[model samples]
Target: MKTLKIFSLAAVSVLLSTVIIAQSKTETFKVSGNCGMCKTKIEKAAKEAGAKEASWNAESKELTVTYKSSSTNAAKIQEKNSSSRV
Candidate 1:
């Protein structure tokens, strides 16, 4: 019985940790841009919109962002990037 209780507690702890870790999310999508300046602007806007990490590829025109889901989401980041002058 004691061993079973410990196992249950351990399982719960692991589940809680997984839930916490899942709050951080990563997303990638295409973003139109032409130059290094556009990359800078797009990345900056994503960060301003609560992205923890932002990378824009000039050749691929793709932006990959990592952020806390509790603080922000992919749509918000995309909206901010779209409104920016890039």
Candidate 2:
């Protein structure tokens, strides 16, 4: 019973750590653009900047991105957009 409790606690700790890590590493920000073409360009730029997932909304002009913090950050993604002239 004690061993089972220890195992369950360990599992919960790992799960919580994963959630925290994922949330802390991901970020959302705005990228300037105007249409479907803009969405395509922005998302492509984000991906090129090392994001694991890049989604842009034309209506809101918001980009939601997920990336490894060790590899990339929000600034890098936005910089890609600005540099690409997209």
Best by lDDT: 1
What global local distance difference test value does model 1 have? Answer: 0.93
For candidate 1, report its TM-score. 0.75
lDDT of each: 0.93, 0.86
**Residue range 11-72, candidate 2, lDDT tens digits:** 99999887766653667788888888888888999999999999998878889998987678
Error of 1 at 75 (Å): 0.2
Q: Give the poorly placed runs of model 2, Cα more than 4 Å off.
A: 1-24
Write model 1 residue lDDT over 58-84, tens digit each, in one string: 999999999998789999999998887
lDDT of 2 at 68: 80
Following a full C-alpha superposition, what root-mean-square deviation does model 1 have from the true structure? 3.5
Residue 86's C-alpha lDDT in candidate 2?
Answer: 29
